[model samples]
Target chain A: MSIFKETRITRLLIISAIILIPIALSGCVSGGSMTATSWPGVTADESNLYIAFNQSVFAINQDNGKVLWRFPVEPEKNQTFFAPPVLTEEGELIVGSYNNNVYKLSASDGHVIWNFTGAKDRIIGGSVITDQIVLSPSTDNHLYALDLASGNLIWSFEANEALWAAPMVDQERVFLSSLDHFIYALDLATGKELWRQDLENAMVDTPVLAGDLLLVGTFGNELISLNANTGDLEWRFKTEGWVWSSPAVYDNNAYFGDMAGNFYIIDVASGQQIERAQMGSPIATTPAIGDNEIFIVTEQGDLYARGLDTAHPLWQIAIEGRMLSDAVLANETLFVASLDADNLVSAMNIESGNLRWQFAPEK
Target chain B: MWDTLILDPMINALLVIYDLLGNNFGLAIIVFTVIIRLITLPLSLQQQKSSMKMQDLQKTKRWKDLEKKYKDNKKKLQEEQLKIYQEIGFNPMSGCLPTLIQFPIIIGLYQAIIRTLAVTPIQLLDLSGHIYQSGFFSIPSSLLPLTSNFLWMNLGQPERFWVTLPIVGLFGIPVLTILVVISTYYQSKLTMATTPGDGEGQGAQMTKMMSLYMPLMLGYFAYTFASGLALYFVASNLLGIAQYSLIKSSKGSNIDLAPVKKSVKK
Candidate 1:
């Protein structure tokens, strides 16, 4: 009887490992392929960091620069991905592909727990994983709500044009922008349209919710903050180029970059431009805040760590390739991935801007 | 006359229906299969008549004489076969036309699904942006974005263990992938055709190979495509069987129920 019990326990452990191994291995690849062109988004949980490149999702060990697993979304050769991966409160990594699919993977292992397919169009926007629902926008001009656990579609909200902005979910409401020149507020539970405010230009950046005001940027280079509950405009800040990067809200200050390589720090409450810093390259990547420092990457492959109060550069590092992905902050270490350098994920010491370690896929 | 006027419109109408129902693509495919069967009723009847006529011609003494005369020379065989067809006032192309038409339509549907359900930045630009923006079911948005997962597939990514569901489910038996492979194999067998003088033994061997090959290829694609497309394929196959049976019944042929059977005698 003792031997039989031991055998049963061993079998159970093996079976469990077999089931969990793929989930664990889902985020291992670090965008190693030569053909992969972009690493637009990277997010992290407690243990793993998720990066999106081409059609694959990579999960990296946050402690050490090791890959845990990789999930390859094999779209047709012509398709390309641009959106970042979003993490849910319950640890679901939600991402969409150019092949019109929104996927829910186990954050721990990268295993697909569920998937939603879009109409015959690409899903360029990253998914927004809320507490109970996952909101994804698609080029199919639709916003889809999926049950995070079962992958069952709860509801969908349609727009007049393509939806390229990642959704922002707060409480029971979800805010989204579309290329149709509109900003929309919808009920997260049923996907019911609450209100739509016309922006008159394509809104591609994910709206940043600061307190009760929601700040959104448009293709026309105008940044507008609206009341999150009423969709009423609070204030607007204009820039020289299109604002595609989502605004980073920190310490009552809203920080964002534009296509012209200019970073603007605006007061969230008043929409006053407090300071503007030029990075000499297009500021396409979002800014990351740490202590008194603000980190921004440019499309020309320049990284700048600037002081938030003084608007002066603390350190600047010029990597080989353009930095398209947002910088991720974990503790004191800042991680940046770039598409130009064969999608390499590099870690920089946030204080000194020193190269700590980098992980490149083995060819 | 039938191909241009009736068949084309019917196929187009069916495609419209596919767009309507669930935006849930898989369900649309099943509906398409049923509609295709209904549209090809006349051609199916003609095919049955031609098949029966060919079987009768095979038993005739005149056919045997022609076969003997053409036995050695391939060119002569072609001449004699043409002569027999001419004498019977039969056009072989007529019987084959339905199958040929169906092939392109099926391929068109597949291409349409792949092109329309794009999920990337580049692919989104390539798709007909106008159609993607069209609303369906008063959903206040385009009908294009729907979840593809029915059981265990993301359907849009290459099927790899890293992204799919864990192998075990419901009683810890791990039945999801098994169902995918088995259904695909059966679907391939049902859709394939048998050619004559494809020696019974050789034909069986070829069919077996084809059955395995087609399922594996589709399974691989299903793993890579959005699960919606896979659902469409599965639904299309099952619906295709129903369509085939309906066509056979309407034509009053001795419906085989099984896939085209190879002759027992080698």
Candidate 2:
């Protein structure tokens, strides 16, 4: 009787452990605690839209919402993508993955051209394509510049923390914003640090080169203007909340929103707010500028179109999931992606708030 | 309510410790665990005393007689056991109350570690809202992206020690997982050894099963989650053993055992 009881207890304990271990460790799985850290990134050309979401990079038809092709054919368990893919003049798609690899694919059909696995950590920001070099920033605290044709390392510059903001390139230099609370300018040819300025807070958006002034938004709740050439602080426009997205520049003015849902129009030259409007939700993506209107998406999945002159919203439409990526405008159509697994991408008529087509992929 | 009361305070405290410890996250976790253990010492001692009293009760003749009498009638045995417990001024819940109170703290510590190592954008965004922005308790935004590197381990990822051997080639060993398993086993063993008898009772069987299963469960957790959490498990287990030993050595010290009387019979 005693032996039977002991055996039964041991068997019960084993059974309980078998049932409980998976349930207990489920939270530790990748993307388990949160669905995703960032939203789906959409980049467009004249023909197709390339979306870098979790587990795959998708190519959608521009005219009709159709899946053209998805990279890797089968989703790899270890690879996750969120950085928007950049297109080259040579019709090549250059993108980075959370697996710490930079892939160059043929734009016509998704075929691997070259793969560069040099970075040591996840790549959170999209690559900036220049004439000669492709600048990719990673969470490993390094901005890597690869040869556009062969995907070979040209040069890399190390930052103090993760580089979540894409590099902004101009004629002779590239400007980088790092979570290390500093903005760095490096020479385009050699990756040598030209100048750097500590903004006293972390920056997560690309530094906009608006003529001679570089405009940067920071977690310090300020829109700062710096001399593009000297890295000197020009002026600071304080906001009600942290400015998380890059400013949209059009017609000599800067348009942006803060995490507190306040949208502002600032005069580019004077760095003074021309007007401010409340969106009622946090905005974390750059606004797309059209002919006479501005398009923005809030974290609460609201899409709004506002006239540039009055800065008042003209129309608004509700999306399904959180809209955290920039709204892209091309060919009288506006494209937006969400964190929803079902309703991944939606294309809308730019003139009206009417939905043109919504693309929901099969599970 | 949980965030406001436990998570937010713990996260901020860890950050404050990290700042004071010169940005070393490993050192901060260690110090924070020690501080938490110190803060809950009173409850731990209360629990220890209750366990000791229960063990003493189990060794008494009245308890053995009640078990033998109730071998046929389980319900009457339970009723008589309750009566005897009341007569002796002992509450069985006293031994479990401290452990129940600690569940939220353990969860809070786990969440605080994950939040402080905010490696993802959404997690980082969530962390930003929880941080003290402006006040006497404000942490600098310069510390936004904290350095998770600690002694060849990225505290944000699972820990492994990579080694290149001649015949086996390159291998990654889970060093912290091993430590967590060993420390947990030792602590559980020490806890079980303090119990009165090793007979074939249901309670003894359950205790034995727990001793065998607890370490494996914790080892699985240590191997799967971020290394920072694994570090917490090791530190917590080792400290628990030390605490048990210290309390055991001071068994002769004066303690208020009002709930436990000498007689176990009505």
Candidate 3:
């Protein structure tokens, strides 16, 4: 009987160990990296970094790369970062999350200034903050403009399909794209549709403003430049794979990569491809531009810092996991958040590409 | 609830595998299922041992004595059984341990699937942004734009008769369903047959009834759920049969039915 008891206890212990070891290992792994897949828009307000991830807004120190404070949002399940938080002229952080709600958080202590609930779909596109209004496109297929101070809904522009791409606020119009294959230019104050241009396929990337042209990428692998005023097609460049990454306009060139690992540097004037750089893995995050250096992180977690003009690698840092979020540049420091690596967020020196500080939230 | 428990995970797991395997959802699911089974093996073995011991105890004379002692008294019977179980260091709750363990896994697996095979814009964006595209089989382009072309199902949505018929008929009959029912029946029979002691006959009788009842219950479930889940059930049952046969053969148990004998009068 004792022998049987011993064996059963041993079996229980073994089973427990088997189950617990993985959980422990997973905890350790998760703790080592800030590798959250949800792209919480990373915005810096001089001294602090505001990141929206998994129903929480984390305020981190710009210098040491430490989390100062975290404010939790309610409705936990499926509550994720949809659009990157926008820093408003009023100094409040405005962001929309997957819970079908938009929150205005205090930049200093990470407190909710106010929150407004929209339709049921998640808000994946980052909020576009203007001087007086904040606009966010949602999976509910509506472009919502809320009062920057009170969190009151001003107006909403409905689309045919869900809007995953963040709306870009220009001088008079808010340019936004949708999975419905249309780029809409709406009046920023009134939420009236100014003009709409139908792309060949769904637009999943946020439109970037380059001079008078609004540059956008689509699910159909087309990079289109439209006249920001009339929504007229300026130029379009075709690629072999889907374009999910938001295009970054630097100098006279628009740089973007595709799902097939091909990076294109297109001239903003004509939409003609000037240079194409192929990386080892697919490029999913937007490239970070600093001075003459352009840093691009791949889905495989390889960070390549190259000369903006030459496309020659200045330095390369290989994170252990895939890079999900775009790298942020603040005060000569490059902050990268990955979902695959043990460290969730890491600070690298802009010049030397040396590791400065790292934080893994789950660990 | 359905989206969280079923649709989302199924899609997510498929997308992860697709991203990893470049769109081969079938291979991804198989590999994922294998990993899950491997993880759950210890719990499964523990449950199996507990079941075997319970069967063994039921056949012992001690059990019969207690039953006879409490034949006319229900409360006393309960107390007596508890006392016997305490003495023997047996827990009836052991039978539920495996089920308890499986519940969370089922939820997790469902989540993985939904996250992987996300077809809609919202689903895809949510999925693509979250999961690591690292999987064994590349998601096939043929399924892209994401089609429900596996047998008779559009894997993106719930399984309907309109979708399942062609897939079912493609096998020249509903052979998969038949195999599913047969394998389930035999697994119950094998467990019943292997139960030690005199109660084996009674256990076998119970097993026979269960075998008939379970298939019907499962058929109803199959009709209602997405064909992906039905496919999963069939795969799991087949795998169970193989595992059972392997264990039985290794244990040198010939699970063939024995002839019932008349009770000898002293």
Query: What local lDDT does model 3 show for residue A239?
Result: 81
Predicted structure 2, TM vs. truth: 0.90
Which model, 2 or 3, shows the larger lDDT?
2
Q: Please give the CA lDDT of all the candidate structures.
A: 0.65, 0.83, 0.67
Q: Please identify which of the two predictions, 1 or 2, would achieve the higher TM-score against the true structure.
A: 2
Evaluated on chain B only, what is the TM-score of candidate 2? 0.89
Error of 2 at B153 (Å): 2.3
Q: Residue A157, candidate 1: how far off, in angstroms?
A: 0.1
Decoy 3 TM-score against native:
0.61
CAPRI-style class, candidate 3: incorrect
DockQ measured for candidate 1:
0.03
* Chain B TM-score by candidate, in order shown: 0.61, 0.89, 0.64
Can you tell me which runs of candidate 1 are displaced by over 4 Å?
Answer: A1-38, A73-82, B1-266
Clashing pairs in 2: none
On TM-score, the leading prediction is 2
The Cα error of candidate 1 at residue B242, in Å, is: 51
The TM-scores of chain A alone, one per candidate, are: 0.85, 0.92, 0.87
Residue-wise C-alpha lDDT for candidate 1, range A214-309, written one tens digit per residue: 998875567899999899888889886667678999889988998767889899999999988776777766799888999988877888888887
